[model samples]
Target: MPERALRNNSTPAELAVWHRISRFRPAFTRQLVEAPFIIDLACRQAKLAVEFDGSQHLDSVERDARRTAYLQSKGWTVIRLWNSDVLANPDGATLHVLEKAAECLGGTHPQPLPSREGRER
Candidate 1:
């Protein structure tokens, strides 16, 4: 799909976060897998899926519960961030997300700093 179109369809909140994250590397977003389920945002290698929770969930608690159960059954770890969280603590939230993903992938929490000046290798 075209870049302009993607931005146009995304929520302003989602777009803002995406813009910041895209500065380094793009994080995956809405995707459909073999079945009909469309994930909010996921990383297959990281085995992580991120979602935004809103008032709608309160109205459909059972449905959300089932969906969470299904994903967990499939071995996918799901993380939920609230709309207010994205608005209030975008930076901290981003770092927390990166930390969780790294943890799941069995890597260091804070990606190690770049190799220093050569000491004559």
Candidate 2:
């Protein structure tokens, strides 16, 4: 399916996760296209792709593995989250994404500002 259509028809789990991650820095793209496949969500700067999978995905483990391998070959780190888990605990799911992103980016996102404890104000 086209990227736009997949984004427009996002599953509940995807929407929940996006709601939390979309507000952060280094921004994430939903329904991102990487040629042959459409990523559920991706932080391009970090080269990280997050995939939210539903029950149907259980039937296609090999297909998903191939997709992940292809993306990995292209230097993308893929993280998969179950739909049930996201719906049950969106905060935890988003935190995992943030942590992975930070790991991939090699530092904290939005880096902390310099302190000015003694500056005139």
Candidate 3:
């Protein structure tokens, strides 16, 4: 499928986020084609889709809304994250995706342990 080609062309942010969540018990597939749409990353078993959007999306709010509505209508919970956010704070982005996935799967999301990297001394 054409969408499968996207896996190898993902942005750095997408790769970072995918690397973290791909280790989940259920697993997520990148560039999953769901007919009318191609999800960035999806855990079909949990009915969750995670999209990493760049600045272009900010100018396409309506388009994004329509896409999101369409996906939600099909029983998929969509989580859209800015690429900058994913790149700048991979742990935070991963946490958000995991939480959303847990919600759609009817389970509690696990929080990452506190870290000192960006914490106040």
How accurate locally is residue 23 in candidate 1, as Cα lDDT from 0 to 100?
A: 39
Tell me the tens digit of each residue's lDDT in model 3 across 8-121. 799999999888887775678899887888999898888898988999898999999999999999999998889988899999998888888778777745334556797677
Q: Per-residue CA lDDT of candidate 2, range 1-121, in tens?
A: 7777887899999999899889887889898889888899999999999999999999999999999999999999999999999999999999889889998999875334678889997
Off by over 4 Å in 2: 110-121
For candidate 1, write residues 1-121 as lDDT tens digits: 4444544576544655555554332245454351435555666766677766766677977887777778878887888877677878878767766777778777754355668788576
Pairs with backbone N, CA or C atoms under 3 Å apart (clashes), candidate 2 = none
- Name the 10 consecutive residues with the lowest summed lDDT in model 1: 23-32
Give Cα distance to truth, residue 47, candidate 1, Å: 0.8
Candidate 2 yields a Cα-based lDDT of 0.91
Instruction: Choose the strongest candidate by TM-score.
Output: 2
Model 1, which residues run further than 4 Å from truth?
1-8, 23-27, 30-34, 117-121
| RMSD, every candidate, angstroms | 3.8, 2.2, 7.1
Clashes of 2: 0
lDDT of 1 at 15: 52
* Candidate 1, residue 56: how far the Cα is off, in Å: 1.8
> Predictions ranked by lDDT, top down?
2, 3, 1
